[model samples]
Target: MPPAQSALVVGAGAVGVSCALQLARRGVAVTLIDRGPVGGGTSHGNAGAILRAASPIADPGIVWKVPSMLMDPTGPLAIRWRYLPRLAPWLLRFIVESRPERHRANADAIWLLGDQAPDAWRRQVRGAPAETLLSPVGWLKVYSSEASYRAAEGGRALYRARGAALEEFDAHELRQLEPNLAPIFARGVLHADGLFALNPRRLVELCAEAAVAQGAVIRQAEVVDVEADDARAAVTLADGDRLEADRLVLAAGAWSRGLAEKLGAKVPLETERGYHLMFETPERSLNRPVVWEDKSFVLCPMEHGLRLTSQVELAGLEAPPDFRRVETLIPMARRMLPSLAGAPTDRWLGFRPSLPDARPVVGPSPRAGAALLAFGHQHYGLSLAARTGEVVADMALGVDPGFDPTPLSAARWA
Candidate 1:
């Protein structure tokens, strides 16, 4: 009888960490590798909107919206001019797939994937030595305009359909709920499913620690290449090191697509370059995370400081991080809450691993069963980490995933 083969997981972001932990938990020999600092990527800088009720930001209307969205540099979402010419076609496909029907379909698929996200995280964190995950109260979405407020109102039906609890808050009610909000902010919506982490760095760092404690090996090296054959997979490192594994799970976030291309799998993976700024503590925050409607970012209260993160720049991974965008977040954040103080203590910009259709790619590679590709989670990467690990692990074990992963696959690109 032969021994079971080892599994190699590339990338050490939240998704990669979660993948490694679940795989190791199942008793697979797991080796987690990364080129740079682990968890230094987008996982650390996200808005911390751990939404169990999150949906893709792309709507069929987005196709039409992109033209205008593309024009504004400081718009909530935009593509840099340098990256625009190459991204035109992808922009088209994104809009085409964002239709109402497509939105609902994608929503169903995404909801399926996110259904048990929080519960899975809770279970993983239960035995781990990680600091508290601020599942804090709930999430608030503020709206300055009536039209936008009404648009948010429509989600009530969608949430009810999906069996997720959602509530709409008028100006007075919203004010009562969050007394600190500026007077100009008239309406708001609260979703009970929202969760946040005060220290995302701590979250992923502790996850890595827990994973190592559970016997998973962490290799600090760049994976220059992953060669797949019928019998096994071999990963070559930039440092001229090589390791073998029976199965390869590519959860490398933004870098996953480029690596997937090495295997001749061309995925429509886009990078949503995101920016976040953490300010000196004004206080514990208005209680929970708030998705400031007009500004198009979520202001979260973390242990580090009041964090403001938003702006999705869809370009390639090679594109530079726009710290200026992160810098811009402070003004909007300060305006929303007068108490937020003068300036941020620290700012960060990281590229979010995004897919053209704003959904993640999971399951077997289009080419081989041995090549498992998981990335393009976009803004929901952290939120979807645990469930995606379960989904990917289920596929690897030949067990049935509780939901359909067809909506999230490389075949979509093929």
Candidate 2:
């Protein structure tokens, strides 16, 4: 296929904006479309950690805890009872991907893109006012029990095998590294290569602004359907308006499955509903992003306030916000940092576009060469957005991305 001269990208979140910026940089006339303002979706409310040490979401250990996780209402993973029937198929595939071999393959695939994430982001924000969003202060994971610390050895080994740098800190060392942390944590692991965003929303807005500055058009519209043939691609908005381009990109995040199916890619995508709580005034300040191992939640300092983000609710897009999940983080946050005693001032829920194998779809559509797929990064979407965008832009422009696209191909499920 020849390089694309014009492209229409659906979705205006981090990944979509990044893709548009990269495509524009490559001289492709690009138009970015989204239902709301840029970054108003999942890209806005997150822990804001540009995680470089992210393991595969499908861990072998999760297979054993699935029963308990499903049963416990306060557990990190929960499923609304009513959604079980619809979630069964995806749950089964998720379990299968939790096998040791599959877990490793998925982790390796994620690391391939993640290892370059910080650099990719650096390049994206270079000379831009939003450069302040990217912080290289690294991420810290704290464990409160010896058993829990020992249990993490396998994950540490995976990071080592992938050549990712990690620094182990005993309780004393951990306290010294983050003086504000409470004395409850027994151990800590620091990913020195990681980066954190001070304001994720601003980062996305900057990317969108950069894309527009580079000659990409920004349109606010809801894309209801997309169609592509051998020659060109077109997207139909909800208002019955249609737009055509030489190439199309589906980066709609959690809302992408329908559009992908319209293009004949039956991706088994599920929404991992994640919640976050923000404190207007934190009693204490954090040096960097820290994850409480036992609770599976993260507390990070952001420009607005201290943000506590985590929880995997296996509910579909239609479900209302379970503010209880956000409320639950309050006590947990206080326990992690006694200084976070203030009441949460804001709460949010966003759908993470997740695939069973924990890898994103970042290549061409099976049904049409004119359409490209770039969604489902799941937990790592923020981390991998820049790299995914670069690769997707390369595919659209017919340039070598310097890596194999097979692992991330949308046709893998087909």
Candidates in order have lDDT scores of 0.77, 0.89
TM-score of 2: 0.98
Taking all chains together, each candidate's TM-score versus the true structure is: 0.93, 0.98
**TM-score of model 1 relative to the true fold?**
0.93
The CA lDDT at 316 in model 1 is 69
Question: Which one wins on lDDT?
Answer: 2
The CA lDDT at 333 in model 2 is 79
Kindly list the per-residue Cα lDDT of model 2 for residues 34-120, writing each as its tens digit.
999999999999888786745877898988877887676667887888998999999899999999999988887787688898889
**lDDT for each residue of candidate 1 in 65-165, tens digit (9 for 90 to 100):** 66675566557776667877888787777777677887788777778767777777777688566637656566788998787787665566766787776
Clashing pairs in 2: none
Residue pairs in collision within model 1: 60-98, 60-99, 198-302
